[model samples]
Target chain A: MTDLNNQPQQPQKEQPGDQPKKSELVEKIQQLGQSNVAQAPDSNIHVLPIIGQVEGHMQLPPQNKTTKYEHLIPQLVAIEQNPKIEGLIVLLNTVGGDVEAGLAISEMIASLSKPTASIVLGGGHSIGVPIAVSTNHSFITETATMTIHPIRMTGLVIGVPQTFEYMDKMQDRVVNFVTQHSNIDEDKFKELMFAKGNLTRDIGTNVVGQDAVDYGLIDAVGGVKEAMEKLNEEIDKRKPDEDEQVIQ
Target chain B: MVLYTPLSEVDIFPADQTAYDSTVITTYNQTPVKAFKLENGSYQIVQVLSTDPSIYLHPDYQPGMQFNA
Candidate 1:
């Protein structure tokens, strides 16, 4: 790499007579062949995309596309401490995974002092619902969908009364989180979760775009443009308060 | 321990591992990206995992563009 750097300089110096008319544009064109694109200042609103399956404590098989919680947890911490970042945008397109991990992420986003927004694209199913609502404001693209469903254990189960009780307790956590963060009430959300005939052989409603907003699950039925505008507005709203604190 | 998803268990956990090994998450010019390993030992950009929206607009960083390993 250092040799390549020297090579470019060497050509300019040695062929100064022959290439005297080699314009800066020509130089740029030559450099463009390489991977050296000039960079701009970092964005104040950092994006955290929750794509594919949200993998938690158990590592999904290698072939499965996963958004690892370990990577995200640290990133969230960095976002909190980074003075350069003023806002967060959680871009969600996930078929939700572990309950605990999803809740952990949702909690983290909800607690962040900086302005935060989430945009649900494709499908923000199951646990993704909580995460989508966790932000200060949320958006869902017109074609996007959100699956509201009850939690279920996949591995071996004892199949006892206590097991059902335990599952209900876990379900309550997700229910509580989504309802608390968004505008949907518990009864309505449960109705959607347990609704039948919507999904073939499944018991959930796949709420699309405007339906999500109508149910009060998401703030609006818009995409990136609206999300950016809302985030900037919230950022501006908090800026004055932060300046006051700095003065104090 | 509970899975809260509309997707089946099989879809979430695939049987094959080789398919996943072909791609890796790495940093290019300070921006983190997921790239596919080419047969010639170089990697091709599959996704740019950066917060800077501008990074996505750069022609050089677009998907299918190759960079040296």
Candidate 2:
């Protein structure tokens, strides 16, 4: 320590209270630099966008846009544990990349204790179907479409009878997850998964907004207005239960 | 430039107005009014308020039936 703080102790004035504002400015600037994703803590609602493709254990090439599983899992934990965060809004616009990675995200969203909602915009293709149905309520914009198809993988594969069985088991995991969380029937979901001729040379059905609702895959055909309103309502509904717990 | 519905009438400017040439209005009240920079001085509505949590297409438009898989 400097002997008796030999520095000049000239002016004695209350420290200005502007430090918080200065830090806030820095935070604002940092937020501005981020792309697509943002969080508005004031409303206690965090917005998470699953865009491009969901990247798995192997990181995708720099050219490919991906939502990494590792990043999102910890984020989901924060949203659940955060006292200020009252709800979650998942915005999905993915071509559906890695099956395991997408399923991990879906499981996290489905398990959140707070009010959760999802709105599929554009194309929530492939594994995105499971994610779209992971929330308590799901919305699909009129223009958005979700493709339901069996799971497929890239890279080398072993040519054994067990390989086919392993693939079938993986497909079942996805199917069960979707049907269990969503209102869609098992048969209906399977039908969509295996349907042919929908996509040129691909086997699956392209389900649009209202059709998604009709098939019980999504809860409503609406936009931000509806999704936010419904989520707010759910948050309000949860308040009393929290109070009841406090009383006990 | 078209400042879409309801938000067009809002006279209040967002704090981020100075950052971008264009104003991003959103339909969701909780979602902040985000702004984007434009090449020219005049700001356009790059983001619709309701579309802040959007993916795929912009809020106002939807892709055709032949969507990329």
Candidate 3:
């Protein structure tokens, strides 16, 4: 009978490329253990960049390029938790992605205790508008443009009453969020969102930076300097009066 | 949960006609207005009013007025 318990053991060997130098392996492990904490002072405001598409939904197919909110949500929580972080500056330059993810991010920023400001760079289109205005104050580059449009679905639309009702409810939620955060009136925003003769093919209005300011969609038509200054002012106002020192 | 309402419904706007000359007509106790020139050689006037802090404040504050500690 074959001895089942006495199995032959194979000799252990490492290939030339597979064997890393002892120091190199130790160094890599050490680096991996180090945390990548942002080192901005508590008094100094930190800028968190939220670029690219906001990702939502599980099982993201290859065709669906989205901005992962999981990564962003933790970063936002970190900003709120960090004692050294006085304020947060959100720099947005996105071609808008997932709606639920974007809205979730916006709500998080809006509810943060720290003074937050957002600057819309190249463009703050679609769901980006709510995020742009979600901060305590918001600014856009003079050249930046914001596209105010209704919610859209990329997949096939079932032409059923329930489908239409769901779409309407979803749209209402977005519109409510945007109007609540920004100065844009809901009716005018709706008009722009469903404008008949704005774009030849699209069903929305593209407001440039200054126009956005005029429409109350954005606070100012300025860049980094203006946004930072506003954020600092808000932060200063929130600080305890006893701790306030007059700066020359 | 607090239901969300549109600002347009809560806020009021001016409703008056202007003469050929570019002068804004206003009623007593009306909100101030800021005027801007549109691209089509037409002027668009927007009412400038202070937003109630309640609109944007965290729910811990009073129902009306700006949130002041």
Candidate 4:
């Protein structure tokens, strides 16, 4: 078996004109620890990572890692426009940032024609909750946690009462999005958001893997393997419709 | 100014804006990437910002790879 595998690679390496190519291949294997397999230029399943902080209007400092809306919005538009891209898998590991930005991303993902599956790996806190549930299906690892919290603002507050109402509206938007997208209801979600003892000195609940599923916040408890399986299944389900359209 | 996050505002926002000016977003092989300009005038990849899954598979496009042109 080993000899047969080696036989096909021998000629390509020994050809006089192929010397430069051979060295490049060797370097690639040495550096990446694997030979680069010939894959189609377009990918049917594209992964969009919602990692670090979801940056919005403010430009975060260079030291901080963030997922900028400008980059993601255009990429998402491209993914939707590209016929080759059939499925989207959103990988979430975000601490959450601006409310509007996070919601904008969630809305875009929710509106995509292609099937999507989101897997919350680490902590998908605050605004990430909406984005996580915005997909066709969502997953969370056994250790992953989702923090359900109310919207808050820091720094100076000129009108405390009006600010509270504005924050309430913002919080309602997130709640409405999550409740509409996922299996969780408004009452239960609000309960989780206002739960007192779950987080010390904080007014929200940090829901762990299975608990999130129990609360109907996430679809299931799983990682990449399960998320990919779900995505492939959804993609396959959509294939027939596309084929029917082609036939017509 | 209205940051909604579980993390402290101080930890999220830096006091100095000049520190962020060193990096720039440019295209490498038709893919958008965030890179830093080295002293030698070459760019080093900081992040591969492409939605194409195959782009990430390329060894040269990986983070920290010295991208020429």
Candidate 5:
């Protein structure tokens, strides 16, 4: 092998007076060809994972793994416009963050004309409540949990009754949206929000798995397999309506 | 050149979708297997690339020798 290394390498036939940089460009192209990410997007169902904390306008530290709303917004637009995509599956496993940003995402998903479904894994706490309910159908794993709590601000406030009123209005938006989207009623949900002993050191209820379904916050208690089947069934139902539109 | 690396370090699904269209997955036994999603949207192995010469040649191999030896 050492003798082979010592042997003078065979020279390649050069294409008439190519610059060294041009040969370097050729190498770069070859490297790009081997990457799986560079391939054209395919597949009918897109899985959008809402993992970690949902970062709003403020950038979280680099150490934090966040599903930035900006990244998701554009992808959601693409998913809406792209005719190739037939359905969407949102998988949520978030500690949840940023009220405004989370609300924005939930609104966009609720307004999408395409068939959509969501499955909550682990804990969908804080503002994640609205997002999980926004989908056409929702599922939560039997072990998954959801925290129903009032809105909170981290920064300085005027500390007045007016500030309290403003917080109350914002909290209403979240409560109203969740109730409207899911089977849960407004009064019952608020009852859960102010429930006692469910969470220590907090004033809210931490609804678990089947408890969530029983409360009608989530449509069912299931995992990925069940969620996919539900999404596909919804997609199939929408097909005839689309074909009818084309005929007219 | 052949690179011997663990599967965990390399991301098999770099794209956004849960199911890949047709990404060839190479196994521990040095078998290169191709998979495709079915009509029902489940994946099944479509081909085994055993006939093709491996792009990766084990560096420590010798004739009539066990891999562990």
Candidate 6:
């Protein structure tokens, strides 16, 4: 007996209006709290993929010029400054690049306080040798190969006595650094650099992952897992004591 | 045939060796310079300097002029 259809229609509550009001309130709250919130932190571990030639002084040959020192240096510095980044894993798949550039990069890596590990995949050759050995610990895939060679100069050969002297000094710098960082001795490295009977065109030794390990150039033969594990171990070693009181 | 003398033997600088700077000029003729005399009586070429003052010779070449070039 109630005429439902004839009943006065109650004012429909606008659900859409409530949603917009709620969104606006949320937006205002976010704006008010934005200044108080700290910036998002960096990751705990940074994995930098260094592919192609490590462009230093020499321009990489055509078809292999992806990575360069200019790009790598800033990234490394950023990683160094980031407090959350406890360690670094450099994934190297380079044929090598400019000597001074590679050396500079390697020196930076060697000097980092943070634990660092490098994994050489594909092939790490020429100047790549220094980078491979720069990290605290190094790993190379079983299929990976590293070419150890004497420092070479491209372009014109003045053949002047001074030019030869410069070459010698530069080569000596590279050799000393490599010998100091790696397990290979200076004499053996020089032999490898000047090895006349092995390679067809170049004078160098090609060491596979295992061979590199045996020569003491690389720490072990492994892949991504081993590299990460080593990096974690380094991080764990450097972890600050939670019980210690901060002087600041 | 050219005869070469060690920088040390020629006494080009001085016997005392302190007063003399021992600085020698060099050219780019590929001739070896004997800086020091060996026990075997053979002179060892230390370096060859450049003919031009702008160019410095390597430490491994002889300093004096040779008849070969």
Backbone clashes, each candidate: 0, 6, 4, 0, 0, 10
Q: Which tens-of-lDDT digit does each residue in A161-194 have in candidate 5?
A: 9999998999999998999999999999999898
Per-residue lDDT of model 2, residues A1-248, tens digit only: 01112433436444676576566456544543322233332346778889898888764443456777776787788778878778889999999988899999999999999999999999899989999899999999999999888887655578899999999999999999999998999999999888889888989899999999999999999988899999999988877676567885
lDDT of 2 by residue, B1-69 (tens): 755533312123323434333333332223222334345532323332222233213221121111110
Give lDDT tens digits, candidate 3, residues A8-122. 4435566676654664446444533322222321235756566666666732432333456765676677668867668888888877766888899899899999888899999
Q: What is the lDDT of residue A186 in candidate 5?
A: 96
State the lDDT of candidate 4 residue by residue for A118-226, as single tens digits.
9999999998999999999999999999898998765557776888888889988998999999998999999999989889998999999999999999999999899
lDDT (tens digit, per residue) of candidate 6 on B1-69: 554643222234224433232322222233222233434544433333111111122211223212221
C-alpha lDDT values of all predictions: 0.83, 0.72, 0.66, 0.85, 0.71, 0.67
* Each model's DockQ score: 0.25, 0.03, 0.01, 0.30, 0.02, 0.01
Candidate 1 or 6, higher lDDT?
1
Best by TM-score: 4
Best by DockQ: 4
Better of 3 and 5 by TM-score: 5
User: Stretches of candidate 1 above 4 Å error?
Assistant: A1-41, A61-63, A241-248, B1-14, B28-30, B36-44, B58-61, B64-69
| DockQ-superior candidate, 3 or 4 | 4
Model 5: how far residue A237 lies from native, Å: 1.4
Interface RMSD of each: 6.8, 21.8, 27.1, 9.1, 20.4, 34.3
Q: Predictions ranked by DockQ, top down?
A: 4, 1, 2, 5, 3, 6
**What CAPRI-style quality would you assign to candidate 4?**
acceptable
Better by lDDT, candidate 4 or 2:
4
On a 0 to 100 scale, what is the lDDT of residue A149 in model 1?
A: 89
State the lDDT at A193 in candidate 2: 81
- Quality of candidate 5's docking, in CAPRI categories? incorrect
Docking class of 6: incorrect
